[model samples]
Target: MTPTTGRRPLIGVSTYLEAGTRWGVWELPAALLPAGYPRLVQRAGGIAAMLPPDDPAHAAATVARLDGVVIAGGPDVDPSRYGAERDPRTGPPAEARDAWELALIEAALASGTPLLGICRGMQLLNVALGGTLVQHIDGHARTPGTFGHHTVKPVPGTRYEEAVPEETSVPTYHHQAVDRLGRGLLASAYATDGTVEAVELEDPGAGWVLGVQWHPEMGEDTRVMEALLLSARPAPLSPSGV
Candidate 1:
Protein backbone atom coordinates (compact mmCIF):
# COMPACT_ATOMS: atom_id res chain seq x y z
CA MET A 1 0.00 0.00 0.00
CA THR A 2 1.10 3.54 -0.77
CA PRO A 3 0.63 6.70 1.26
CA THR A 4 -2.34 8.87 0.49
CA THR A 5 -1.94 11.16 -2.50
CA GLY A 6 -1.28 14.88 -2.02
CA ARG A 7 -0.91 14.99 1.76
CA ARG A 8 2.19 13.34 3.18
CA PRO A 9 1.98 11.38 6.42
CA LEU A 10 3.71 12.96 9.44
CA ILE A 11 6.29 10.65 11.03
CA GLY A 12 7.78 11.12 14.48
CA VAL A 13 11.42 10.04 14.83
CA SER A 14 12.81 9.78 18.34
CA THR A 15 16.06 11.59 19.16
CA TYR A 16 18.98 11.30 21.57
CA LEU A 17 20.65 13.92 23.74
CA GLU A 18 24.35 14.66 23.88
CA ALA A 19 24.96 15.37 27.56
CA GLY A 20 26.91 18.46 26.67
CA THR A 21 27.78 20.11 23.40
CA ARG A 22 29.56 23.24 22.25
CA TRP A 23 28.43 24.70 18.94
CA GLY A 24 28.87 28.31 17.92
CA VAL A 25 27.05 30.35 20.59
CA TRP A 26 25.43 27.52 22.51
CA GLU A 27 27.11 25.03 24.83
CA LEU A 28 24.42 22.89 26.41
CA PRO A 29 22.36 19.74 25.92
CA ALA A 30 21.37 19.02 22.34
CA ALA A 31 18.66 16.81 20.88
CA LEU A 32 20.11 14.81 18.01
CA LEU A 33 18.89 12.44 15.31
CA PRO A 34 20.73 11.07 12.32
CA ALA A 35 20.07 12.99 9.11
CA GLY A 36 19.55 9.67 7.28
CA TYR A 37 16.37 9.00 9.24
CA PRO A 38 14.39 12.02 8.09
CA ARG A 39 15.79 11.81 4.56
CA LEU A 40 14.60 8.21 4.30
CA VAL A 41 11.09 9.17 5.40
CA GLN A 42 10.96 12.00 2.88
CA ARG A 43 12.15 9.71 0.10
CA ALA A 44 9.36 7.32 1.03
CA GLY A 45 6.77 10.14 0.77
CA GLY A 46 6.23 11.16 4.38
CA ILE A 47 6.93 14.23 6.49
CA ALA A 48 9.38 13.66 9.32
CA ALA A 49 9.33 15.16 12.81
CA MET A 50 11.93 14.82 15.56
CA LEU A 51 10.73 13.76 19.01
CA PRO A 52 13.28 14.54 21.69
CA PRO A 53 13.27 13.02 25.14
CA ASP A 54 10.53 14.71 27.11
CA ASP A 55 8.13 14.23 29.95
CA PRO A 56 6.80 10.71 29.64
CA ALA A 57 3.42 11.99 30.79
CA HIS A 58 3.02 13.79 27.50
CA ALA A 59 3.83 10.81 25.30
CA ALA A 60 0.24 9.81 24.52
CA ALA A 61 -0.80 13.35 23.71
CA THR A 62 2.16 13.79 21.37
CA VAL A 63 1.54 10.47 19.60
CA ALA A 64 -2.12 11.31 19.09
CA ARG A 65 -1.27 13.89 16.46
CA LEU A 66 1.35 11.95 14.49
CA ASP A 67 0.55 9.61 11.62
CA GLY A 68 3.41 7.25 12.41
CA VAL A 69 6.31 6.79 14.83
CA VAL A 70 9.88 5.57 14.42
CA ILE A 71 11.85 4.60 17.52
CA ALA A 72 15.20 5.67 16.14
CA GLY A 73 18.30 3.67 17.06
CA GLY A 74 20.57 4.90 19.86
CA PRO A 75 22.14 4.02 23.23
CA ASP A 76 21.34 0.77 25.01
CA VAL A 77 18.17 0.53 27.07
CA ASP A 78 18.69 0.42 30.83
CA PRO A 79 19.07 -3.31 31.49
CA SER A 80 17.51 -2.79 34.89
CA ARG A 81 14.21 -2.15 33.12
CA TYR A 82 14.30 -5.77 31.97
CA GLY A 83 15.61 -7.14 35.27
CA ALA A 84 19.12 -7.72 34.00
CA GLU A 85 22.46 -6.66 35.43
CA ARG A 86 24.74 -4.59 33.24
CA ASP A 87 26.80 -6.76 30.93
CA PRO A 88 30.39 -5.61 30.41
CA ARG A 89 29.70 -5.26 26.69
CA THR A 90 26.43 -3.39 27.06
CA GLY A 91 26.68 0.27 26.25
CA PRO A 92 26.00 2.82 28.96
CA PRO A 93 22.30 3.18 29.78
CA ALA A 94 20.41 6.19 28.56
CA GLU A 95 17.90 6.38 31.37
CA ALA A 96 16.03 9.39 30.04
CA ARG A 97 15.77 7.93 26.56
CA ASP A 98 14.68 4.59 27.95
CA ALA A 99 11.79 6.16 29.81
CA TRP A 100 10.73 8.42 26.98
CA GLU A 101 10.76 5.73 24.26
CA LEU A 102 8.98 3.26 26.51
CA ALA A 103 6.26 5.81 27.05
CA LEU A 104 5.99 6.39 23.31
CA ILE A 105 5.78 2.64 22.70
CA GLU A 106 3.05 2.28 25.29
CA ALA A 107 1.05 5.09 23.76
CA ALA A 108 1.54 3.78 20.21
CA LEU A 109 0.49 0.26 21.19
CA ALA A 110 -2.59 1.53 23.00
CA SER A 111 -3.72 3.72 20.12
CA GLY A 112 -2.83 1.26 17.35
CA THR A 113 -0.48 3.75 15.78
CA PRO A 114 2.06 2.49 13.25
CA LEU A 115 5.58 2.13 14.68
CA LEU A 116 9.04 1.01 13.48
CA GLY A 117 11.83 0.30 15.97
CA ILE A 118 15.48 0.07 14.96
CA CYS A 119 18.45 -1.35 16.92
CA ARG A 120 18.11 -0.07 20.49
CA GLY A 121 14.53 0.76 19.68
CA MET A 122 13.97 -2.91 18.79
CA GLN A 123 15.45 -4.08 22.08
CA LEU A 124 13.28 -1.61 24.00
CA LEU A 125 10.18 -2.87 22.22
CA ASN A 126 10.85 -6.43 23.36
CA VAL A 127 11.39 -5.29 26.94
CA ALA A 128 8.19 -3.23 26.81
CA LEU A 129 6.34 -6.36 25.71
CA GLY A 130 7.52 -8.50 28.64
CA GLY A 131 10.42 -10.13 26.81
CA THR A 132 14.15 -10.29 27.44
CA LEU A 133 17.32 -9.48 25.53
CA VAL A 134 20.50 -11.46 24.84
CA GLN A 135 22.43 -8.59 26.53
CA HIS A 136 25.49 -9.11 24.34
CA ILE A 137 26.34 -11.00 21.19
CA ASP A 138 29.83 -11.20 19.77
CA GLY A 139 30.47 -11.01 16.00
CA HIS A 140 27.23 -9.16 15.18
CA ALA A 141 29.29 -6.02 14.92
CA ARG A 142 32.57 -6.16 13.02
CA THR A 143 34.30 -3.26 14.76
CA PRO A 144 33.90 -0.92 17.74
CA GLY A 145 32.07 1.90 15.94
CA THR A 146 31.23 0.75 12.47
CA PHE A 147 28.26 -1.00 10.85
CA GLY A 148 28.65 -4.47 9.34
CA HIS A 149 26.75 -5.85 6.39
CA HIS A 150 24.89 -9.16 6.70
CA THR A 151 22.07 -11.07 5.04
CA VAL A 152 18.69 -11.50 6.66
CA LYS A 153 15.94 -13.94 5.65
CA PRO A 154 12.33 -12.97 6.21
CA VAL A 155 9.76 -15.48 7.28
CA PRO A 156 7.30 -16.45 4.55
CA GLY A 157 3.80 -14.94 4.66
CA THR A 158 4.84 -12.27 7.13
CA ARG A 159 4.85 -8.53 6.62
CA TYR A 160 8.63 -8.46 6.84
CA GLU A 161 8.77 -10.90 3.96
CA GLU A 162 6.34 -8.78 2.01
CA ALA A 163 8.39 -5.59 2.39
CA VAL A 164 11.86 -7.17 2.07
CA PRO A 165 13.35 -9.82 -0.17
CA GLU A 166 13.74 -13.41 1.03
CA GLU A 167 17.43 -12.68 1.51
CA THR A 168 18.54 -9.09 1.81
CA SER A 169 21.78 -7.57 3.00
CA VAL A 170 21.36 -4.99 5.77
CA PRO A 171 23.58 -2.59 7.71
CA THR A 172 23.74 -3.95 11.24
CA TYR A 173 25.45 -2.58 14.38
CA HIS A 174 24.13 -4.03 17.56
CA HIS A 175 25.48 -6.22 20.39
CA GLN A 176 22.07 -6.98 21.88
CA ALA A 177 19.32 -9.04 20.26
CA VAL A 178 15.85 -10.16 21.16
CA ASP A 179 16.10 -13.42 23.09
CA ARG A 180 12.47 -14.23 23.96
CA LEU A 181 9.47 -13.58 21.78
CA GLY A 182 7.42 -10.65 23.00
CA ARG A 183 3.75 -10.97 23.77
CA GLY A 184 1.68 -10.92 20.58
CA LEU A 185 4.89 -10.70 18.58
CA LEU A 186 6.64 -13.09 16.18
CA ALA A 187 10.16 -13.37 14.87
CA SER A 188 9.64 -12.38 11.24
CA ALA A 189 13.28 -12.41 10.14
CA TYR A 190 16.60 -13.95 11.09
CA ALA A 191 20.27 -13.97 10.17
CA THR A 192 22.38 -16.88 8.91
CA ASP A 193 23.89 -17.25 12.38
CA GLY A 194 20.33 -17.74 13.80
CA THR A 195 20.13 -14.25 15.33
CA VAL A 196 16.67 -12.73 15.31
CA GLU A 197 16.75 -9.82 12.89
CA ALA A 198 13.16 -8.62 12.78
CA VAL A 199 9.87 -8.96 14.65
CA GLU A 200 6.25 -8.09 13.93
CA LEU A 201 3.06 -7.96 15.90
CA GLU A 202 1.13 -11.24 15.54
CA ASP A 203 -2.31 -9.67 15.34
CA PRO A 204 -2.95 -8.55 11.79
CA GLY A 205 -5.69 -6.25 13.03
CA ALA A 206 -3.16 -4.28 15.00
CA GLY A 207 -1.68 -1.35 13.10
CA TRP A 208 1.71 -1.76 11.51
CA VAL A 209 4.36 -2.49 14.16
CA LEU A 210 7.79 -3.75 13.17
CA GLY A 211 11.19 -3.93 14.87
CA VAL A 212 14.35 -4.65 12.91
CA GLN A 213 17.83 -5.09 14.32
CA TRP A 214 19.41 -3.58 11.22
CA HIS A 215 19.44 0.07 10.15
CA PRO A 216 17.26 0.43 7.07
CA GLU A 217 17.61 4.21 7.07
CA MET A 218 21.38 3.82 6.75
CA GLY A 219 20.95 1.78 3.57
CA GLU A 220 19.26 2.26 0.21
CA ASP A 221 16.18 0.22 1.00
CA THR A 222 13.04 2.35 1.30
CA ARG A 223 10.51 -0.49 1.46
CA VAL A 224 10.47 -0.60 5.26
CA MET A 225 9.85 3.15 5.51
CA GLU A 226 7.26 2.92 2.73
CA ALA A 227 5.40 0.23 4.64
CA LEU A 228 5.13 2.53 7.65
CA LEU A 229 3.79 5.35 5.51
CA LEU A 230 1.16 3.04 4.04
CA SER A 231 -0.13 2.21 7.50
CA ALA A 232 -0.01 5.88 8.48
CA ARG A 233 -2.43 6.95 5.76
CA PRO A 234 -6.03 7.38 6.71
CA ALA A 235 -8.57 4.87 5.35
CA PRO A 236 -10.61 5.97 2.36
CA LEU A 237 -13.93 7.56 3.24
CA SER A 238 -17.23 5.95 2.17
CA PRO A 239 -19.20 7.56 -0.66
CA SER A 240 -22.55 7.60 1.16
CA GLY A 241 -23.78 8.23 4.68
CA VAL A 242 -24.05 5.15 6.88
Candidate 2:
Protein backbone atom coordinates (compact mmCIF):
# COMPACT_ATOMS: atom_id res chain seq x y z
CA MET A 1 0.00 0.00 0.00
CA THR A 2 1.18 3.53 -0.78
CA PRO A 3 -0.20 4.98 2.43
CA THR A 4 -2.11 7.49 0.32
CA THR A 5 -4.40 8.35 3.17
CA GLY A 6 -1.40 9.73 5.01
CA ARG A 7 1.31 10.03 2.36
CA ARG A 8 4.74 8.46 2.94
CA PRO A 9 5.42 8.78 6.62
CA LEU A 10 8.29 10.90 7.86
CA ILE A 11 10.27 8.79 10.30
CA GLY A 12 12.67 10.50 12.69
CA VAL A 13 15.68 8.40 13.67
CA SER A 14 17.50 9.47 16.80
CA THR A 15 21.24 10.15 16.49
CA TYR A 16 24.40 10.10 18.56
CA LEU A 17 25.85 13.25 20.01
CA GLU A 18 29.60 12.84 20.09
CA ALA A 19 32.46 15.18 20.87
CA GLY A 20 35.59 15.73 18.74
CA THR A 21 34.46 14.30 15.42
CA ARG A 22 36.45 15.21 12.30
CA TRP A 23 36.02 14.63 8.60
CA GLY A 24 38.31 16.94 6.65
CA VAL A 25 39.53 20.00 8.56
CA TRP A 26 36.83 20.67 11.07
CA GLU A 27 36.90 18.80 14.37
CA LEU A 28 34.07 19.74 16.63
CA PRO A 29 31.17 18.28 18.56
CA ALA A 30 28.75 16.61 16.21
CA ALA A 31 25.44 14.89 16.16
CA LEU A 32 25.95 11.73 14.17
CA LEU A 33 23.74 8.92 12.92
CA PRO A 34 25.07 5.91 11.08
CA ALA A 35 24.29 5.84 7.39
CA GLY A 36 22.59 2.50 7.80
CA TYR A 37 19.90 3.95 10.03
CA PRO A 38 18.59 6.46 7.52
CA ARG A 39 19.13 4.01 4.64
CA LEU A 40 16.91 1.46 6.34
CA VAL A 41 14.12 3.98 6.70
CA GLN A 42 14.39 5.05 3.08
CA ARG A 43 14.44 1.45 1.95
CA ALA A 44 11.24 0.76 3.82
CA GLY A 45 9.35 3.55 2.05
CA GLY A 46 9.55 6.22 4.75
CA ILE A 47 11.37 9.52 4.63
CA ALA A 48 14.26 9.51 7.09
CA ALA A 49 15.21 12.44 9.30
CA MET A 50 18.10 12.60 11.72
CA LEU A 51 17.13 13.74 15.20
CA PRO A 52 19.96 14.88 17.42
CA PRO A 53 19.74 15.23 21.17
CA ASP A 54 17.98 18.44 22.08
CA ASP A 55 16.39 19.90 25.18
CA PRO A 56 14.42 17.01 26.65
CA ALA A 57 11.43 19.28 27.03
CA HIS A 58 11.24 19.68 23.26
CA ALA A 59 10.84 15.99 22.59
CA ALA A 60 7.06 16.02 22.84
CA ALA A 61 6.81 18.87 20.41
CA THR A 62 9.25 17.21 18.03
CA VAL A 63 7.35 13.92 18.06
CA ALA A 64 4.05 15.67 17.52
CA ARG A 65 5.27 16.69 14.07
CA LEU A 66 6.81 13.36 13.09
CA ASP A 67 4.75 10.49 11.72
CA GLY A 68 6.98 7.90 13.39
CA VAL A 69 10.09 7.82 15.55
CA VAL A 70 13.16 5.60 15.76
CA ILE A 71 15.50 5.50 18.73
CA ALA A 72 18.86 4.53 17.24
CA GLY A 73 21.47 2.32 18.84
CA GLY A 74 24.09 4.08 20.98
CA PRO A 75 26.14 3.99 24.18
CA ASP A 76 24.98 2.51 27.48
CA VAL A 77 22.04 4.16 29.17
CA ASP A 78 22.80 5.74 32.55
CA PRO A 79 21.89 3.21 35.24
CA SER A 80 20.59 6.00 37.44
CA ARG A 81 17.55 6.30 35.19
CA TYR A 82 16.38 2.92 36.40
CA GLY A 83 17.65 3.24 39.99
CA ALA A 84 20.63 0.91 39.56
CA GLU A 85 24.33 1.23 40.23
CA ARG A 86 26.46 1.39 37.12
CA ASP A 87 28.08 -1.90 36.33
CA PRO A 88 31.84 -1.73 35.78
CA ARG A 89 31.40 -3.33 32.41
CA THR A 90 28.78 -0.85 31.28
CA GLY A 91 29.98 1.78 28.87
CA PRO A 92 30.25 5.37 30.01
CA PRO A 93 26.95 7.23 29.98
CA ALA A 94 25.80 9.54 27.25
CA GLU A 95 23.63 11.44 29.68
CA ALA A 96 22.30 13.99 27.23
CA ARG A 97 21.31 11.39 24.66
CA ASP A 98 19.78 9.23 27.34
CA ALA A 99 17.68 12.05 28.75
CA TRP A 100 16.61 13.18 25.30
CA GLU A 101 15.68 9.78 23.94
CA LEU A 102 13.79 8.83 27.07
CA ALA A 103 11.71 11.92 26.61
CA LEU A 104 11.13 10.97 23.00
CA ILE A 105 9.91 7.54 24.04
CA GLU A 106 7.56 9.11 26.53
CA ALA A 107 6.24 11.52 23.92
CA ALA A 108 5.76 8.77 21.36
CA LEU A 109 3.85 6.61 23.82
CA ALA A 110 1.73 9.48 25.02
CA SER A 111 0.83 10.69 21.54
CA GLY A 112 0.34 7.24 20.01
CA THR A 113 3.11 7.82 17.50
CA PRO A 114 4.54 4.68 15.94
CA LEU A 115 7.97 3.94 17.42
CA LEU A 116 10.79 1.53 16.61
CA GLY A 117 13.85 1.06 18.76
CA ILE A 118 17.00 -0.85 17.81
CA CYS A 119 19.92 -2.15 19.92
CA ARG A 120 20.66 0.40 22.65
CA GLY A 121 17.29 1.82 21.78
CA MET A 122 15.76 -1.39 23.12
CA GLN A 123 17.63 -1.12 26.42
CA LEU A 124 16.43 2.46 26.86
CA LEU A 125 12.88 1.38 26.10
CA ASN A 126 13.05 -1.09 28.97
CA VAL A 127 14.39 1.49 31.37
CA ALA A 128 11.90 4.09 30.22
CA LEU A 129 9.14 1.68 31.20
CA GLY A 130 10.47 1.05 34.72
CA GLY A 131 12.45 -2.05 33.78
CA THR A 132 16.03 -2.98 34.59
CA LEU A 133 18.96 -4.35 32.62
CA VAL A 134 21.32 -7.25 33.04
CA GLN A 135 24.25 -4.85 32.41
CA HIS A 136 26.60 -7.48 31.07
CA ILE A 137 26.10 -10.56 28.90
CA ASP A 138 28.25 -12.88 26.85
CA GLY A 139 27.88 -14.45 23.39
CA HIS A 140 25.51 -11.89 21.91
CA ALA A 141 28.42 -9.69 21.00
CA ARG A 142 31.32 -12.07 21.27
CA THR A 143 33.68 -9.84 19.35
CA PRO A 144 34.35 -6.37 20.59
CA GLY A 145 33.71 -4.00 17.67
CA THR A 146 32.02 -6.11 15.04
CA PHE A 147 28.49 -7.34 15.03
CA GLY A 148 27.76 -11.00 15.78
CA HIS A 149 24.85 -13.01 14.48
CA HIS A 150 22.11 -14.79 16.37
CA THR A 151 18.82 -16.45 15.60
CA VAL A 152 15.77 -15.33 17.52
CA LYS A 153 12.47 -17.15 17.88
CA PRO A 154 9.41 -14.99 18.24
CA VAL A 155 6.68 -15.65 20.71
CA PRO A 156 3.68 -16.92 18.82
CA GLY A 157 0.89 -14.39 18.03
CA THR A 158 2.95 -11.35 19.02
CA ARG A 159 3.54 -8.37 16.77
CA TYR A 160 7.16 -9.40 16.33
CA GLU A 161 5.91 -12.79 15.23
CA GLU A 162 3.40 -11.19 12.91
CA ALA A 163 6.24 -9.37 11.19
CA VAL A 164 8.85 -12.10 11.41
CA PRO A 165 7.01 -15.31 12.12
CA GLU A 166 9.85 -17.77 11.70
CA GLU A 167 13.13 -18.02 13.55
CA THR A 168 15.68 -15.75 11.91
CA SER A 169 19.27 -14.66 12.28
CA VAL A 170 19.80 -10.96 12.96
CA PRO A 171 22.79 -8.70 13.21
CA THR A 172 23.48 -8.74 16.93
CA TYR A 173 25.72 -6.35 18.86
CA HIS A 174 24.99 -5.54 22.47
CA HIS A 175 26.39 -6.30 25.93
CA GLN A 176 23.35 -5.50 28.03
CA ALA A 177 19.88 -7.07 27.80
CA VAL A 178 16.51 -6.42 29.29
CA ASP A 179 16.12 -8.18 32.62
CA ARG A 180 12.86 -7.12 34.23
CA LEU A 181 10.43 -6.19 31.52
CA GLY A 182 8.89 -2.74 31.80
CA ARG A 183 5.29 -2.25 32.82
CA GLY A 184 2.88 -3.02 29.96
CA LEU A 185 5.63 -4.57 27.85
CA LEU A 186 6.22 -8.21 26.86
CA ALA A 187 9.19 -10.14 25.61
CA SER A 188 8.23 -10.97 22.09
CA ALA A 189 11.35 -12.94 21.10
CA TYR A 190 14.24 -14.79 22.64
CA ALA A 191 17.70 -15.91 21.67
CA THR A 192 19.24 -19.37 21.86
CA ASP A 193 20.52 -18.69 25.35
CA GLY A 194 17.13 -17.28 26.38
CA THR A 195 17.99 -13.60 26.18
CA VAL A 196 15.20 -11.15 25.50
CA GLU A 197 15.94 -10.19 21.90
CA ALA A 198 12.76 -8.30 21.14
CA VAL A 199 9.95 -6.59 23.06
CA GLU A 200 6.62 -4.91 22.39
CA LEU A 201 3.47 -3.71 24.12
CA GLU A 202 1.72 -6.40 26.14
CA ASP A 203 -1.71 -5.56 24.79
CA PRO A 204 -0.39 -3.64 21.72
CA GLY A 205 -3.33 -1.25 21.32
CA ALA A 206 -1.34 1.82 22.51
CA GLY A 207 -0.05 2.68 19.07
CA TRP A 208 2.88 0.73 17.59
CA VAL A 209 5.99 0.19 19.72
CA LEU A 210 8.76 -2.34 19.15
CA GLY A 211 12.30 -2.69 20.38
CA VAL A 212 14.78 -5.21 19.03
CA GLN A 213 18.14 -6.00 20.54
CA TRP A 214 19.55 -6.65 17.11
CA HIS A 215 20.72 -3.98 14.62
CA PRO A 216 18.16 -4.32 11.86
CA GLU A 217 19.71 -1.44 9.91
CA MET A 218 22.92 -3.43 9.61
CA GLY A 219 21.23 -6.34 7.90
CA GLU A 220 18.83 -7.14 5.07
CA ASP A 221 15.62 -7.44 7.06
CA THR A 222 13.14 -4.81 6.04
CA ARG A 223 10.13 -6.41 7.68
CA VAL A 224 10.60 -4.66 11.00
CA MET A 225 11.02 -1.20 9.52
CA GLU A 226 8.20 -1.85 7.08
CA ALA A 227 5.86 -2.62 9.94
CA LEU A 228 6.61 0.75 11.59
CA LEU A 229 5.86 2.52 8.35
CA LEU A 230 2.62 0.59 8.10
CA SER A 231 1.52 1.81 11.50
CA ALA A 232 2.25 5.41 10.53
CA ARG A 233 -0.35 5.15 7.80
CA PRO A 234 -3.75 6.43 8.86
CA ALA A 235 -6.99 4.84 7.72
CA PRO A 236 -8.94 6.80 5.14
CA LEU A 237 -11.81 8.98 6.32
CA SER A 238 -15.36 7.67 6.09
CA PRO A 239 -17.60 10.67 6.93
CA SER A 240 -19.09 8.53 9.69
CA GLY A 241 -16.09 9.20 11.95
CA VAL A 242 -13.99 12.06 10.56
lDDT of 1 by residue, 196-238 (tens): 9999899889879999999998899899999999888653445
Q: Once model 2 is optimally superposed onto the true structure by TM-score, how far is the C-alpha of residue 71 displaced, in angstroms?
A: 0.4
Report the Cα lDDT for residue 40, model 2. Answer: 92
lDDT of each: 0.89, 0.91
Number of the top-ranking candidate, with lDDT as the measure: 2
Worst 10 residues of 2 by lDDT: 1-10
Assess every candidate by TM-score.
Answer: 0.94, 0.94
Across residues 7-39, which tens digit of lDDT does each residue of candidate 2 receive?
577899999988999989999999999899999
User: Each candidate's root-mean-square deviation in Å?
Assistant: 3.3, 3.3
Distance from true location, Cα of 83 in model 2, Å: 1.0
